[model samples]
Target: MAGIFVYAETKEGEFRKATGEILSRCRGVADATGEPLVAVVVGPAPEDAPRRLAPFGADLVLHVEGPGLEVYTSQGYAWAVTSCLAGRQPAALFFGNTPLARDLAPRVAERMDAALHADCTGLAWEDGRFVFTRPLYGGKLLARAVSRPGHPVLATFRPNSLGVAEVAATSPAYERVQVEVPAGSVASVVKETIRQVAGRVSLQEAEIIVSGGRGVGGPEGFRVIEELADVLGAAVGASRAAVDAGWISYDHQVGQTGKAVSPNLYIACGISGAIQHLAGMSSARCIVAINKDPDAYIFKVADYGIVGDLFQVVPALTAELREMLVRA
Candidate 1:
């Protein structure tokens, strides 16, 4: 069958936020092309997974279940996705530009001899072609690309870069495809998975982020940042300088060398906002910078700037937000 296929990524048995973001974007393309929206899942099926995908406009869900699939192995996931493509070809295959997708999408495209585009922030069907837009030169520019005709197009989207559709009560139809892992196909075994236990939101998936930098002083300084983030239900982020100083773990770092995030609201506390740092979060919908230095480069890109010591300002703001939230 000719349709649109989306790789629904999951983490620890729950759907990743990127799954809904990609599906919502693909839904528009499917509607335009007059094709069914097929969501493919490779792993132990989560209860009500298909029903959850329906709200994002998945007309059908293809569940691929098999041994050696519970933990993500590049080879195993690639093989399973290719197996689902055996009897049918999709107009375009979509995957989130996540770590797993980064490894699996290229492999699947290579197996199918299809064209692939990575880190696409925008996708559109124009003039009978699927045009994908992705950032280049550290997000200094956006480049548009399209695949050759007569080949299945493949693309991976950055998380939170696209919008998510509202949830619906209706459930999509489901189909189960049993995959047989070929001998010698499975190479690595996942011994253990250590999950990060922190704020409610994952940095990549967070809508609001409160980030600190070297100006925060020391490890103890992060408490203020965390308190503000907690009150706002935002994720805690750190500049590369903070991580390098050992004030926080590298996982909290956000810069060219670290994670790129595009949250709805990015509160940069005490960050000088170097070009490298901006490269990672310049795409945020709104940027708020709090720094004592009015000359801080971060203020240049901030939608709102507050010149003050973050220590006092952050606590005051957190207290105000708490009171307002309580009153509401």
Candidate 2:
């Protein structure tokens, strides 16, 4: 039987949601092609990744133990992954379309000279070949790409392209592989690995997010956004303008230069949507936009919209939601 390799990502000794999603997707690919799903998690052996990958359908967990690998480096990670691929030569390789994957996938593809596809929304096996569906022309069109003339066809899937990882059978077997990572200078030197700043959240992982932009007025105005987020049990996000205005942290900024998110619900307050910002979050399941301008681009994608002053609309919305929750 063929095999499909998955790069299970981890942070602070825990598996990221992307890892679970990739493993789940690979389960389908494995069942369809009758290939075993092999997950390679490069980090310390004591990490929680091996245990985490099991329920998602990993048949064999390749634990690549190495020094300083707990911290991510493009060169080190690619070397370790490609080296493992050299031995297994799987039918295809899958990764999450995150910043790390964005940085690492292309490097591995270049090393393996394998066919590569990015931002895939759907994946399937057709005619004994791997086919991928991805958005093109700024989400205006969808294009299909097939692994043309390649072994170990490489694909990176967008986060939230698949749903939450469901429960499965327990305790898949794990194999620890000792890999000697050749030293390199390209690794990201860690000046500091601080957690989330005083305000703002990891938009990519949030279930709900309240984002603010220039229309938010000022740094003080973000307080209202935070209050709304608190009431909704949501995270706080920001537009580039808000970050540029020093109203919020850069990590919370949602745009091309910032994080891409696909939350269950995304609420944009006082933001005039830019293409870059929309590109990051257009995939959200539901969106609510509040802005004074009736012609704001954010309204285009919003599931619900309020064409009124955000200052007035947001407080009223928050108060109403709070009262409704209390009543319930």
Candidate 3:
């Protein structure tokens, strides 16, 4: 059977949240096409990758590892993925829209002569074809795309789009493929990896986000936003204005040029809601805007709006939440 394959990505030996999300959704895609759900793990994958994937609708787990593939080198990973696809010839291959996938997926598509779609936010099976929906013009418009018949399809989906949900667990078999990467295949090697420490959840995986903007006044002003975020156990976010103002780091930025987020609850404090910023978080399940400006654009998309001094309102909101959450 031509199966539906997923590139199961990992961080620190555990599955990334977006990986689980793609698998959970693709489980339906596999069932619709009457094909096995296959997961491909590559490059420093966990030894228990197969065991971990079996309960997530995976019927088969393919582990690919070898010299030059132990760490992520685009050339090395691409070679493994393209080779696995050649042998399996799956109907479609899905990947989370991680930096690694953005680099590797295109290479695989090119190698396999497959149709490629990137940054898809939605997926569905209809009329005997798989449909992928992606944003265009910096998230102002949307477009649906499909692949030509008789061609393998490769797609990358944005994180936090299709959230993880339970799927019928299946006992899955495992296999390993060791390909000695040829010389010159890997152009560069990573000598050391330096990781940043973040006390809160990763923005892409966070269910709730508390964001601040220029109205925050300064970097120290973010303390209130952080307090609110702490009360809700949410991640902290910032608009491009705050980032450009040097009030926060770019890693916390949310905008057209920054990270797109789709948290369950997005709280925007002191943000004027520039279109670019809205483009990043408009898909949040619920938006709460707190701005002193009554006509701020953030109110347009907010599920709840509070027109007042964010400096005063945010602290009060934080205190109230802290008390309520503690009691509950």
Ranking by lDDT: 1, 3, 2
Q: What pairs collide in candidate 2?
A: none
Put down candidate 2 lDDT per residue, 44-82, tens digits, no spaces: 544555567777888878887776566778888888888
Q: Return the candidate ranking by TM-score, descending.
A: 3, 1, 2
| Candidate 1 residue-wise lDDT, 222-277, digit = tens | 99999999999999999999999999998888878888888999999999999889
For model 2, what is the error of residue 36's alpha carbon versus the real structure, in angstroms, after optimal superposition? 0.7
Each model's Cα RMSD = 1.7, 2.4, 1.6
As a whole number from 0 to 100, the lDDT of residue 209 in candidate 2 is 90
Rate residue 194 of model 1 by lDDT.
81
* Per-residue lDDT of candidate 3, residues 39-73 (tens digit): 88987888777778766788888888888887888
Error of 2 at 169 (Å): 2.3
Q: Which of the two candidates, 2 or 3, achieves a greater TM-score against the reference?
A: 3
Clashing pairs in 1: none
Q: List the residue pairs that clash in candidate 3.
A: none
Residue 263, candidate 3: C-alpha displacement in angstroms: 1.1
